[model samples]
Target chain A: MTSTETHHAAGAASSTDAPAIATWLTTADHKQVGRLFIGTGLVGLLGGLVLAVLVAFERIDAEGFQLLDSGSATQVLSAARLLLTFGAVAPLVMGLAVAIVPLQLGSRSIAFPRVAASGFWMWLTGLVLSVAAIIGNGGPSGGESEMVDLYLAASVVMVLGLALAALSIAVTGLTSRAPGMGLLRAPFFSWSSFVGSIALLMSLPVFIGTSVYLYVDHRYARAAFGGNFGVNNWVGWAISQPFTYVLAIPVLGFVLDAIPVLGRTRLAQRPAANVAVGLVSVAILASLTHRAVTLPWEGDGFFSGLGTKIADLLPFGLVNVIPLLGLLGVLGLTMLTLKSAKPMLAAPLPFAVLGLLMILLGAASHLLYTVEDAALGGTIFEAGSYVAVTFGTVLLAFGGLTYWGPKLWGRRIPDKAALPLALLGFVAAALGSLPYMIAGFADQPAGVVDGFAYSGPQELWNVVTTGAFALMLLVSLAFIGLAVRSFTAGEAAGDDPWDGTTLEWATSSPPPADNFSDLIVVGSEYPLADIKNSGKVG
Target chain B: MLTLPPAPQPAPKRQVFVGTALVSAAATMLVGGMLAIWSQFRADAPFRESPRRGPIKDWMPKDIVVPEVAANMMLIAFFVVCVMAQWAVWSAKRNDRQHAGMALGMTLLMGLATLNAQLFIWSQMGVDVRGGAFNSMFYAITGVMTFLVIAGLVYTAVATFRYLGRGNSDVPTLSAHALYWYFLTAAFSAVWFVVYVQK
Candidate 1:
């Protein structure tokens, strides 16, 4: 028998029994759930991009009522934050974990498949409700208290669903591995998901409790989270700084694992890399330090006097700086791993490199926010920084999709399409964020529309940011077009696409219903590599 | 014909047992995190200046009575129910079916009794939910716990019924259910210690 036939003959089993639509909707299969998450997240991402474009359009004119009213602008800003963070990134990562963790660990299915399905539905429900509520003018700054309450309730439910999904992934990672697959031997993506899941599990619940109380106060008492506190605090904990880093943690895994496979080498300092991922959990707690920071800068002179402002970062530096340190650790180790490896010519490389750069850009911006003289908080710079990190996740998610797409859809996303898209994504991310950072240094504020006194440089910056956002929207469209096309009609990908080191590569592209026909005993992190060298299917 | 090993099954027996225990521990962490945030908010809440801070009003009747005897009774009964649940699991594992059934049945009865007592406590509360931040927290935490308890009781009841009907039970499944029950017990104990007894 051919190697492909031998591999398929060994472990393939038919676990799916229902009709197509029914199967997808009711699937306990990790792959389908992952697809569901990715599809849903893509839609959510598109929605967020559309909202961002609208906001960008308004910002282009730098003066009165360019594209939206004050209330509309505020609503769009808040909605984009909600959709991108809760509706897009979390789902994207969770979906990948649900689909990939079991396969990576050499398990047939996730530990709690039904629970994972339940979590998806719950998340979908929450996302739909929240998006609707926000669109209907029903959040913190929305005039009506009832709408705000709906917003609060919807957000809580959405976050809860994400928490449930993370819980399932974590438990699966912890419990469902093959007989000999120790924690250290699990794929980087699985390990990162495990750590990120714990972080989400611990953090989201606090947000839920706070939201519950917000509900209570709004509904009856009117005693807590007054003024913009309700909205700002939520943004602070859920979308900003350390929280975003923790959310971005899985992408680090995606890059780590993808790089090793693409580079044809084992991870350098694997244990240290795992610890770097682990450090993010502690870094999540450090997110609280941001609440104490406020920016009071008035002009470009802030940069000229950087040393004095940086010194102001000392008091909050211990906690506020941890996430940056973690990112640096990841970057340092990734470089070390790549140094010894024979890197392949592949699409994931550009995506990974750009992803790390964007993460660093965001981290640098976060550091600036902590510096008292930098006075960058509540400005376009901070928002730009957040976009950078968020965009980093998008790139990583795209990289993961590109890396795993063949295995998932039985087709490679034509490199002709993917390579250009990755490059465009990087340029767009840079254009989208860097100019805004300059504008923030120019003393341009964030989260406001139709109010700032128009200045020459500020207007120029706004125009640049607007143009970049327009390009980003186009890139997003092109990506969606390529992804959909490839998913349906692209060239067929074989079992091992990237000479991947992990277990998932051992099975066929779009693995069979039961994942594998026979169990593959995992002896090391690079199990598939071992099999390849041994010239055996099993 | 080569038969591939059966498609990866759900977590193995021991893993299921340990996994559920881990979930319970995580659940505790969640509850603990919530409490920590709530306490911080409680401390910072602008209580004195609020119009809602005054005596109980006529329009909004009090739903929760503070420090009621029924509240204490409910806590004690919950403890008893938790103990009975463990007894049922232990008896079943020891192959003592009769005692297991009896203990499980008693556990369910007491669980319902505890729920009813909590409802009683809710009715007797001298403060409205809107009375203050403390009042809001007290109700929110307890109210959520009550709903959780009902859900856990239903789950345990189903597991118990299956055991009685089949004349056999999967120890892991039973243990998982029991583990969740214990989580509920521990969570409620925390609420009792902080919200009811200490406050």
Candidate 2:
């Protein structure tokens, strides 16, 4: 066995001591389950990326495809593209969020990892069934009854998984903690992750429940969105804005986490982060309430009518902008702080910096929910922006994982040179997205398959995006290799590697199965730093 | 050899009572559903309109827009029964099994009644979006009510399964699942009789 395993063995009897498959199934050992959660989420992310690339190709050349010279219309292709927007991509992103946030909080694992695992399995099953139905020529209009039913089932599974993950995270946050990790003292990223987890747990179900009804009626009951004659579009609108929050919140966490470390100061204000989270949650609920009465809800609708007027009692959406402004101000503060702060080229810093920059672009633009061109949104710009934001968060998560992974494994990855690929991955994606922004400005239809047949800046943007994508892929592959190697074969990390703050780094590199056996008292935010300065070791 | 007294059989007969009440409520729901369907559809005048001034007609004049009276009445009654049944379940928590069972029986009877009412309403519309937003409101509200009734049935069934296996049920799971059904029923019923009825 490895030294880390020997250290783990020295601690106490282990869950791994159980028979093989049952050990995985029944173990409450948080680290094992956490690996499963992260691995599963990454795989899901990869699948989502594949779908994204295909959709972007289809949209870029909307005029048709001449590669086959088979007479394909943009209208037909766009319908398929629309399906990807709601049906495929959104759910994929959500699945990833469910897995990532819970781990960030220093919880052993989510409350019900089995349920969490089941949720993933059920979700995949639903996706396969729904995608198959669609691939076999199905939309709300074209699909048979069986196909629609299957799609509804798939949505249920995705929601179930999200709910399961959310609950697990919340429970862990509330009941499990690394001793001395008070709610107020939680790592900003973990705090944001905690708040976002709660928001998602509640909000996702309502959307999932409504979406199922929409699918049911569209296929089996009424043409809700299609038949414009007298349909109540409230559900349609509810689906849109709440979804934006689901997409935004975790990245919000990423941005929050990056600021303090990168800036070399405490957050501009702790309460500001708390308020941002609360405002966002309230905003989501109030906005949906706007839809609770009407057919289609809008960002503005939640504030306008009698029911909306009552909801306007809070003007939460407006209040929401306040925290964001405060956050932006803090981000600005961080920029100022980073100047004075020591710039270290460690695993977490460069990616943390790039990721934070990307988040600034993403979170800022999303705050303005005004309708944009579907053609524009469908363009490579939107995809590029999504990649920028996603990679930024993913990069931060990688840094956090690596920074703490050794702590969790009791082995800091030695050979720091193995880190460039991870940083490169973030840089490549950030730069890659640049071309898409330009292509979108030129009105190049994105997600299109063929290019030469069309002529313009959109085409030029598409070419650039494709070239950038190759770089991104290379970087990503390198990142995976580096990560896998470090996780398994890197240098032995001690319990306190970074002279860190927080309780997780205070105890054994990986704490016991029950987490820290005794609650450590917190005298400062960075507890381990003081310990390290004192040169305290057993 | 067996000299049990009929007057006072035993002390602490609570579990038996609660179990009986649940089983009976399930039975009531199933039976009432059958009776409502038989009475409304088995008779020849399933679609006949009532010209006479009924208490409900006076209470909600707008409800008069729908021509059929029997289905509407059954629907409203079922909505009431669902509320009563949930009340009974709530009371059972206090060891009031008989009251709980009675409440559940009421809910089941009402749930069945609502189901028949739905069938009648569906027959009237043939699923068409007519009678203005009122028609849509009427159908949507009742449709939600129907789903709740079915959900209630599932929650109780899951509870029964847990009870059989563990001796004590997963109360949180039951509460989480049951609370939604109860609220949905209460809300749908209230909307039907309170909001849409007068509108």
The model with the greatest TM-score is 1
What's the lDDT for all of these models?
Answer: 0.76, 0.49
Put down candidate 2 lDDT per residue, A76-165, tens digits, no spaces. 332333333333333333333443333334443445555556655555565556456545444333335565455555655655555555
Docking class of 1: acceptable
Give the per-residue lDDT of model 1 (tens digit) for A23-124: 677777778888899899988888887888778778866665566778767778888877788778888878878888888888877877777888888889
- List residue ranges in candidate 2 displaced over 4 A: A1-33, A51-109, A112-114, A139-149, A174-182, A227-245, A254-265, A277-330, A336-340, A366-384, A407-419, A446-456, A506-512, A519-538, B1-182, B185-199
Clashing pairs in 1: A11-A516, A11-A517, A11-A518, A12-A517, B64-B125, B65-B125, B65-B126
Docking class of 2: incorrect
Supply DockQ values for each candidate: 0.41, 0.07
Candidate 2 per-residue lDDT, tens place, B1-199, comes to 5665454322222222332223233323322332222232224222334467433222222344443465457545755654664565466566565565555555555656666766776676454444332333334444544665676666555544543333322333334334444454544444444433433
What RMSD does each model have against the real structure? 5.4, 10.1
